[model samples]
Target: MIKSVAHAMIYVLNQDEALDFYKNKLGFEVGDDMKVEGGFRWLTVYPKTQSQLQLVLAEPKEGPLFTKDSAEKIRSLIEEGAFGAGVFETENCQKTYEELVAKGVEFIQPPTEQLYGVEAMGIDNSGNWFSLVQREK
Candidate 1:
């Protein structure tokens, strides 16, 4: 049986831009950024407070995982904002939203009171949307 998740993949168009967005805008820390065989870059980022699960910033190219056609389709879908990254927990949704907005993060929804708590929807530089939530205690 699996104990827990160690990494999650987030497909991106450009690794450098994704790195800047996740690191600077969201304040995530870099876990691993290294070049492997076949010139593939293995980059991962995680929240500052939590480093257990790293988000792999992977660029979809014609490689082992996908064909040229599939890679193109995935890239197109990513640019169309059809994919969601994941929900990010925050202590204060409103405050985090304000900070992110000031840092050039695009938000489709402002912090609103949800059934569980406050929630806001934001889009990363790569057009992946994610929810910022503050759960009720």
Candidate 2:
């Protein structure tokens, strides 16, 4: 049975930059970073409190995940900021947004009240946008 999520992926232009962004900007901790067989680097990170799941910092190139053409297409999309990494929950959307902004994270939208929560939209270093939300209590 599928009990929980293991890894979520976000294709990046550079792994080192992504590591710095996620680790330094987003305050995520390194989960695993090692060279696996077939010349792939298995790099993953997780939120400080959420160690059960990892966010895979993928470089979608001509490898196990994509062909050359497909990789190029994905790279183009990422460069264009045409992808999203889904919602990330936070305890305080406004506070978190300010912290992230101070750390050089770019936000397309500042935190605002929504029916379900307070939300802000931000872009990762790879151009993937994600929603930061603090749900209504």
Candidate 3:
């Protein structure tokens, strides 16, 4: 049987930029920052609350997981705004959105109430969209 999701991988143009965005802008703590085989960087981050689940930030390049052509295609798709990298659950959507905006994060939409919850959409430094959601209490 399939288990719960462990982590999510997001392709980034530059690891340094991604690190700054995730760490400084969004307040995600750095989980891993090291180099593995084939000169590839293995970097990960996790939210302050969900420290168990990490988000992998990988650079699309020639590697065992992806060929050069495929990496290019993925980069193109990301640049075209075709990817929703992940959703981040927060205790308060509006407060978190305001804090992120003060740190220069660009938001696609402000917090809006829906049947499910209140959600705010924002784009990461790599152009991947993420939803900041707060479930109704």
* Model 3 lDDT at residue 119: 97
Please give, for residues 64-137, the per-residue lDDT of candidate 3 as tens digits: 77899998998898888787868888889999899999999999999999887999999998899999899988
Off by over 4 Å in 2: none
Instruction: Write one digit per residue (lDDT tens) for candidate 2, span 3-116.
Output: 999999888998999999999999999999998777688899999999998999998788787889999999999999988877899999999999999999999999999999
What lDDT does each candidate get? 0.95, 0.92, 0.89
lDDT of 1 by residue, 20-129 (tens): 99999999999999988877889999999999999999999987778999999999999999988899999999999999999999999999999999999999888999
Model 2 C-alpha RMSD to native: 1.1
Sorted by lDDT (best first), the order is 1, 2, 3
Q: TM-scores for all candidates?
A: 0.97, 0.95, 0.93
Off by over 4 Å in 3: 1-4
For lDDT, the strongest prediction is: 1
TM-score sort, best first: 1, 2, 3
Best model number under TM-score:
1
User: How many clashes in each structure?
Assistant: 0, 0, 0
Alpha-carbon RMSD, candidate 1: 0.7
